[model samples]
Structures are given as structure tokens and as C-alpha cells.
Target: MTVKKGLKDAYSLKTPMDSVNLYRAWASTYDNDFAIKNDYRSPSEVVKYYSKYSKKTDTPILDVGAGTGLIGECLREQNSRKIDAIDISSEMLNLAKSKQVYSKFIEADLTKKLNIASSQYGAVLSSGTFTHGHVGPEVFDELVRILKPGGLFIVTIHTGVFHNQGFKQKLSQLGKCISPPVFHKVNAYGSKIDKKHGNDKVIITVFRKKMS
Candidate 1:
């Protein structure tokens, strides 16, 4: 298939190499393409939820799957300045950097060991990263590892992913790693994209790591 076709068909790719290439191809247009087309608002939504329990404003927040800094934009709008972003795509990071949202940008894949020190961030957030063909709950191990005790974690996990990807089991195994986790039903993958999609569906989840 032509490269253009590959970019268009990115959602179907399940392999690691394809995931990297797909983001590489779509990075430049991502903010306008998927972000605008689907009315992507999960970034702002994630930040908004975390605001309910805003912690240290001076420490860094680790934005996983920060793709184009949609969440960073929201965080910045709220006057958050210590946010740092990490993504697998250098191209996407470049776009995010131009927005001047994140204090620092790290290029790292969620499926691999992130080159970040442990218990460093005061909070962690992500959106549109745990969907089909992307990173999964296994990344949470690293997330839990790096987050300081009492750090907040807000993530938007696709409902299908929550059930099918052993997230439940992982959460059970990870008990007390964080306070009792709660799932919130915030809109995701807009209806304009699929009228048949569950209008009642949502993917927002929020939690706070317990003091160790």
C-alpha cells in the first residue's frame, strides 16, 4: 500500500514497527487531522479531572503519549507550567514543543522501559494512548514505579481495552499501588465518527497513588 494509505489505515496496525511508523507519518498533521476530525477533547478532559485534586504546582507532571501536546495545551491554559511530555514519535514531540506547553520533552515508547527516574513526577496524565493497537496496562508498572507516593494519575483507557487487555487483573494485582481506582464515563471517540458507536460509552479513569 502507498504510504498515504498506511497513514490513513494506522488504527488497524498492531505491530510495534507499524505503530512507530504510523505516528511518524501522521505526526505533522495529527493535531489537525485526528484531533480536529474526531473532535478530540480527551486531553482537556484528563487535565480537568486531575484539577479536582490538584497537587504540587511546582513539580513536573509526566504526560505519557503526549502526542502533539493536546493535554499540555489544556494544562497550560490552566496555568500549569511544570509539565513534561513523553512520546515515541520525535516528530510529534517537535510539534508539541512548538506549542511551548511542556517544560521538557522526552522521546520514549510506553511499551518499553522509559528512561525516566523513579518517583520523580508529582502527577501523571495521558489520553488517547491506551486505545486499540497502542500501549496497554503493562505500561502501568512503569507508571506506578515512577510516580511518587501520593502522586495523581489520570488516564483515558478505552473501555474495550479495560476489559480485554487484562487491565482488571493487573489492577487487582496492583492493589494498593494506588488508592481505589475509579472509572469515570467521559465522552471519547466522538459520535460523528460512528453513529453506531455507544453514545453512552466513556473511557476516563482517575486515581491517586497511595503513600508508600
Candidate 2:
């Protein structure tokens, strides 16, 4: 929980409390130590795809597992839409708050129902949330529930668990509720510079809620 080991510590987290403890210790320096040092690319990549596929620009957006406001920061550079940040760690949320990039911040566990109403957001983008020991495909139901009809839901899922963790099957089962997922594969880190997790990849899954 007292994570000093960076990515390994993040990937080894098992319980929600484990995540809380890890981020609590890592939050202050997360931007420089974890994201910049590792050359993390998921946030930018996910946002890039969000801009590419999103049809609306004014509706509210929810940044899940927003962690230090990386996604919100990237989003702000592109638009002025109301973007809200949500994460499980208050410490991390505090760091995100300092960035002043989000309109609202919600601290909640993704494993349970968010206090938000259904079909509220025009688009929802999450980066570095669905991975080794963090969140899983089960949160997809709640995510979809909060998304408006025809809303875009874009997220990065660690490729290592895509098929084994039932994400593929779960997405398939959501047939009528969502459109078929469009997967964009990208390196989680700048492979050329970071040798440790250089080969690590995440599937940026893009889908929309059915208007019906």
C-alpha cells in the first residue's frame, strides 16, 4: 500500500484500500514520478480518440479514475465543456483539484454504483483505470448507465487482461445497450524511452450507448 515502486506497486494493488494507500503515498509526486518518468501515454491517447469520435462538444464529460487530472488537463487544452473528475483516492483527487482542470470532483469507488443519475454525461473518458489489479469490466455497467443515449464512452484497458478478464465477453453481451466496441491499441508508455514496461499495451475501447 505504501507504494514507492511505481508501476509495479500500482499493478500489484488488490483491494480498493490497497489502491487508496498506494495513491495516498504517491499522489504528490505522481505527475512527475509516475506519469512523466514513465512516459505514460494513455491519458493523451485516450483523449485524442475522444476528440476524434465525439460528436458533441458542449455536453458534460466525466473523467473516471482521473488521477492527478491528466485526462482533464488534456481535455481542457481542446475544449471548454464541463468536465468532472472521479477517482477512488482523495489524495489523488486533491492533486487533481490543484490543477483546476475539472469542473467537479467526485470521490467514489468504481466497483459500486456512483451517486450520479443515469444517462447524465455526453461522454465519459477513463485512462489507466482498467488494468492488472485496478478495476475490471464489471464497472462497465455503471459506466454505461451514467452515459447518455448516443454518448461516447472511451477507456483504456490493459491488453494483458482484455480477453482473460472477461472484458471481451462482457462487451459482447452488452449487445443492444451499446454499439460494438472499436478497439485502438496503443503503448501505455513511450516504448522507445521506457525499457521496463516498453512493451506494455492498452486497448482504447470506444463505444456509444444506444439511443433506444
Candidate 3:
């Protein structure tokens, strides 16, 4: 994949919010420039892996930071289930909505309190939230609260130097308050061409909420 020098430069920035804004600005060209590259297989693989354990029930799925609904579309392809996509960027959600891949799209920051109600989702899946540091540990509680008992939370994180052990520990602490959620590493892949910095080792993690 040919990496644009401008995107490479942007990836080297010190803050995660810089990357988020950069993505927000490039949301229009995101699919052509980044998402479709690498055979569009990275995010597709994430959804495919998680779908295996998802219950056959027609439960609602929430895709956090659901940029352009790539993962959501993949999930829909795997199973005829309803998906709600949420992202902070309207531009991104606009592209996602145009595809008609999600049943609902909400513009909201996952790091803040999500407006979603407790026990609303049977499963929550996120493909690109943690890697860019757009979300921190505090958001896990909201994710847990939004999921029904025995629900699943699937997320992806960068595995190399950028991985936040401190934030993971904080999430672990918060897990103690919820029904014991178990975290398991699912798969690893490369980031977008713009995110070539830090060696960009993408690791997907799955957390399943225990039934009461």
C-alpha cells in the first residue's frame, strides 16, 4: 500500500485527538483512500471473528466509533441483525448512513457519557476506538451498562508502544464493579495507511458480560 506522506506525518503527532480530527476532516475520502485498501479485510475480519460467538437471537448491536460503518456492514452481512452506529464525527456518520448499512447512526463521543440507556444492547462492537486513544477506561462502564446481561463487547486496540496499559488496568478495575467480564485477545492486524507510526500493531479484544 502506498502511504501518503501527508497522512504519515499526521500519524506521528503526539495526541490522539489530532488523529481523530484528522480523520474527521478526511471522512469524505476515507473509504477510497484508506478503508478499501488492504482488500478492506482488516475490519471485515474483526467483525467476522466476533460474529461467531454472537447469539442467534435478533438482538440489537451497537458499533461504537463506527466509522463509515465498515464493521457494521460486515456484521450485517454475517447475520441479519439490527446495528446502531455511533461516532463523534457527523462527516463519518454521513458516509456510513449513505451506505444504508446501519439501522441507526448517532453522533456522540464515546469518551463522554453515551446517551444510550442501560441494558439496551445485546452486543457492542468497536473496531477503531481504542487505537487512536479517542476513548479511555471511563467509557468501559458505559459500554457495560448499555449491554444486557451476558452481552458481548468487542474492541480493537493498538498492540505495540501505543497500547495503554494504564488505561487497561483502569478498565480492569471498573470490571470489578460489573458482572465479571472476561477479556480475550482475538486478532492482530495493521492500521490504516495514515497510521503507520508506532509500527501500528492492531490487536482486537473481546469482553463478554457474565450473566447474573
Candidate 4:
């Protein structure tokens, strides 16, 4: 799928391939155009919150949908633990590699082939992924599968009326099955800038995998 040349390419997700292509095309200016405007504080805030409950261990962190290495860079600054970032777009991963924030970068599709093993990561962090509207239950299941017992999964979601019903219920069910993971509402006032794209309310949800 080739990326469209304008703003429509940025907000619309016609297919999973389109999302990958769009990010690949937008990688050069992704931070300048979107990251700063929408989620400037997301990476830092995620690091801060995760640090409060857990210490940085030698175990690696898996950053899903890790575009441009923003989250990996934030994690690196917090401590020197290994960080592996994965994205579907080689262009995006290339941009992320240029930042020199992650220890490893892999190109893979979360919904199709994760390529990461179960109980391998100490934490799994993602930002700006769920909000993109492409992720579904399959991605969620893969995320849960990759986490070690007691590992952390942090993510942000575009809030809407739909969050109160269908999506919320699915997440609740996921939490129950995935080592009893618990969701915490993260306030957006400190981490995100209010923007008018859609009527979606963005919220961060942190889940802790239960210890085996």
C-alpha cells in the first residue's frame, strides 16, 4: 500500500498495510508533525509511572509499535537496561535507529507475526498505537503473551463512547485471563495536549501482569 501525499494519510487507516506505509512515509517528520502535538509527554510519563512500581532490571523491554524510538529513548534515559523496539515499517524503524535509543529494532507485524517469545520481557510499552484505530483483540493477545509474569504493559487509547461498552469489556476480559492484569486510568492533563482531530478522549492504561 502506497501512502497518500497529504493530511488524509496521517489520520486515516484504510488497511493494516496502509498504516505501515503511512508511518514509513511519515517517519522523517513524524515527531515534528504528530508526536509533539499529540503526545509530547507520553514517553516520559510512562517511564516515570513504571519506575515508581518496578526497578529497571537486566531483562529487556519490548516496545510495540515503536515508531521513531521515542519511548525507547525515554526508557534508556531512565536506566541502561536493554530495549528492543518493533514496528511494521522499515522506514519508521530506520528513523528510530537513527535516534540510537534502542538496543535492537525489529520489523514485524503485531497482528500477524510478533516474533517475540512468551515471558521474555520485563515490560511492554506502547504509545500512540491504540489511538490509531488499527489495533484489535489479536494484538492485545500477542502483547499479553510476550510479557513475563509480573511484567508491565503500558498503553494509551483514544477515548470515545465506544470505550464505555465493547472495547472496555474486551479489555476487562483480557485482564482477567492475562495473569489478572489490572488497568489504571492515567490522567491526560499531564501527558498529552488536547487536539481536535476526533472527539476521542485519550487515556493511558497501565496493566501489571500477575506474578506466577
Best by TM-score: 2
Q: Please, what are the lDDT tens digits per residue for candidate 3 over residues 83-193?
A: 888887887899899878689988887767878888888888877566533555567788888888778777776564234545567556766545444444533334544
RMSD of each: 2.5, 1.8, 4.0, 3.7
Across residues 36-118, which tens digit of lDDT does each residue of candidate 2 receive? Answer: 88788999999899889987642699999998999988888988778999999999999999989888999999999899999
In model 4, what are the clashing residue pairs, if there are any?
A: 159-201
Off by over 4 Å in 4: 1-8, 37-39, 161-165, 179-200
- Regions of candidate 1 where Cα sits further than 4 Å from its true position: 1-8, 196-200
Backbone clash count, each prediction separately: 0, 0, 0, 1
Best by lDDT: 2
Reference-based TM-score of each model? 0.90, 0.96, 0.80, 0.81
**Model 2 global lDDT (CA atoms, 0 to 1):** 0.90
- Model 4 scores worst on lDDT over the 10 consecutive residues at 190-199
Error of 4 at 44 (Å): 2.5
The lDDT, on a scale of 0 to 1, for candidate 1 is 0.78
Tens digits of per-residue lDDT, candidate 4, 102-189, equal: 8898888777857777888888887667754456545777787788877877776656422643557667777665544445555433
Best-to-worst ranking by lDDT: 2, 1, 4, 3
Model 3, runs deviating above 4 Å: 1-20, 161-165, 177-199
Question: Predicted candidate 3: what Cα RMSD to the true structure?
Answer: 4.0
